[model samples]
Target: MSKIDSAERARALDLVPVSRETAERLDVIVALLEKWQRTINLVAPATLPQLWTRHVADSLQLVPLAGQVTRWVDLGSGGGFPGLVVAAALAEIPAADVTLVESDSRKAAFLREAARVAELPVTVVPARIEQVAAQLAPGVEVVSARALAPLSRLIELAHPFLAKGAVGLFLKGQDVDNELTESAKSWRISSRIAPSLTDRSGRILIVTSAVPLAPIKEAAGNAKGSTHD
Candidate 1:
């Protein structure tokens, strides 16, 4: 637990630093992602240079917001973004745990390896968001998602977890205004949008509720990949 400077310490938010011990593990994750992506195409290659900020820092930024979150579920954890970063930072917080859910097998494998090398208490579930109906742990306090879908779809994908009493934290882009407008038509959830630490145009949505569409309508929407994915 080396003492980081004020700014860097602020970044950890009373948690742990992603320093030497953690860096080695994170490096392993990065290396593996870069390697597998050549064939599987996980993350956008052009974004590699900002991986530390766009992905890692973006996820880690949440640590300070919820200073003592013990458990979290990350939906659509493609390429491990905030999910792996959250797990790695939480690895330093006693009793902290995270679950990373990804539909892609290659991404799931990367998440598993990241957890192993980082020695973080994280579970990776390789399944589509809709397939895994919301049985999150009863006491899970936080639920996060990154680059998954529109705000409306995110609320639907998170319906299960939100119903189970988890607060939703989703990373969205500048077009949030348009998405929010469209999402309002189908679901009703109270949310606050905040600026993202990594991307100037990105927004972090903090939500508390999500009303579901009727089963008949939901089923119809699913057929078109519009309800949840």
Candidate 2:
């Protein structure tokens, strides 16, 4: 097994302290991710060295934002960022669970195995975000996506859950201002931007509501015409 940076793990725990059991589960997830990377491009290869601070800590920061919400749906849960991470923390909470949606079959397989190994309450769905949006949106309390899409399209993809009162917590980069501006053209977003605990350039968008300004068909057409993220 490749040795993880102890200092980095400590730094991440300081940022978002978790129970020992949860921390252990997260460790297992990290190991699983590292193993899977050999065969699948789970995350950016360059980011592996700083995985604890960059990905794990970044994902851990989202846990407190949901504030006891147990039912979560992680859209585009590539490599199980906040999804599995959230599930790790919520393991102690009664009835807490996270549904991870990943379209790539290989990645989905990794998620299932990781969740199993970590003993987290997670359901891995091997399907596209659009295909299962409505089915999964019904009772989800929180919706999350990291590095998935632009704010405009993300809102579109997460609309069903948001409209039904699920709070959306999306991790974004420095271009957030531009993305927010672009999103405003299509959606009336009720949100607040929170500074990231890990990266200075990162921002966490907490969206309480998002009502589309365009007609449904128009929005669908626009989504189809735009480049996929």
Candidate 3:
């Protein structure tokens, strides 16, 4: 990316004041992403060239909605995306901790290294979303995911957090409407779509309601008994 375009991208992201420190960290993030991309395929190859607008800025969009969140859980955290981006931003703010969850060990390693180099207080949890759900603190105030799962499944994975009254924010693409409709089939929830700050074609799903799906073991057992009866 050209120096001119980098400056423009920073301005568009509203990284006010643009401290030398902040600018340096942003550069490091891009460098790490470029290095890791060779092996893990973290982000879309086409999007790598525009990592500023496509990833960093896109992730920072959540910073505005984070109002007073002391702790946050990011699910399916591939290559750190919003999770690490938010962690870096939060360090500038007061009293915020970020946790990144990823099932892939390689991606988790990337998140761990990124968080360490950035000196951001981020916890990397290398586990599947469902397995890690029970360990999340009930007091967490926000949960986020990007391109992780359909809306309904996202809700299911986040049920523990929502049950404790935490809000859910998901980054979705053009199919958001279809995902919302499909989500409604299995869960009753309230949500809204906000225009993405980075991509006009993208939308953020702000969710406030979440209900657990019946356990698979229980649901299957019930089906079998009904059939026998």
Candidate 4:
């Protein structure tokens, strides 16, 4: 395989300030991501070159929003965005853990390897989101997803986690208002959208409460229809 430019990757990581240890782990994960992308299509082809800023930084921004809490559940952790990234940060905390749920076997394998390479404390669940939410939700303090599904759908899959008192931190692009509007009609939700540090067009959704106000019958079937993990 051709060599990935470490200098360039480090420059991209400079966008977000991290501890030296976390920086080393992220650097390693970047190289591993580039290596895995060659075979499994871990992330989008267009975004691969900017993984540090576009994915890593964007994912890392969620850590502060969640305070000192640990125990996270990242659904559809395809490329291990905020999930594994957060795990690397929480590795120093004795009680910290991030459970990555990915149904795709190949992606799950990549996630497992990435965590091992970074030595982050992550539990890779090679199963669908619905299968594990029931067993994992109650103890979780945070639940996250990125480009996993639409806003309405995200709320549905995260319900189990939120209902169990976990905070939801989801990375969403510009259409967030529309998604929130659509979601409000079916579910009574308590959420806040914050600016993303990595991208001007992106938003970080912090959801605290969600209750079913009504059922959606159309395309997505009230969020439950689309469970990415």
Q: What is the C-alpha lDDT profile of model 1 across 166-219, one tens digit per residue?
A: 888887889988887898788777788888776788888888877765441453
> What's the best-to-worst order under TM-score?
2, 4, 3, 1
Each candidate structure's TM-score, on Cα atoms with residue i matched to residue i, is 0.81, 0.93, 0.85, 0.90
lDDT of each: 0.69, 0.86, 0.74, 0.81
Report the lDDT tens digits of candidate 2 across residue range 1-229.
4545667889999999999999999999999988988888777777777789888999999999889798999988888887889999999888987999888778889989999999999999888777788889988999998888778888988999998999999999988989999989989999999999999999999999999897744244222111101
Q: Between prediction 2 and prediction 3, which has the larger TM-score? A: 2
Alpha-carbon lDDT of model 4: 0.81
Pairs with steric clashes in candidate 2: none
What residue runs in model 1 are displaced by over 4 Å at the alpha carbon?
1-24, 213-229
Query: Which candidate ranks first by TM-score, i.e. highest?
Result: 2
Better candidate by TM-score, 3 or 4: 4
Worst 10 residues of 4 by lDDT: 220-229
**How far is 198's C-alpha from truth in model 3 (Å)?**
1.3
Top candidate by lDDT: 2
Candidate with the larger lDDT of 1 and 3: 3
TM-score of candidate 3 versus the correct structure, residues matched by position: 0.85
Residue 209, candidate 4: C-alpha displacement in angstroms: 0.4
Better of 1 and 2 by TM-score: 2
After superposition, the stretches of candidate 4 with alpha carbons farther than 4 Å from their true spots are 1-12, 215-229
Q: After superposition, how far is residue 137 of candidate 4 from its true place, in Å?
A: 0.3
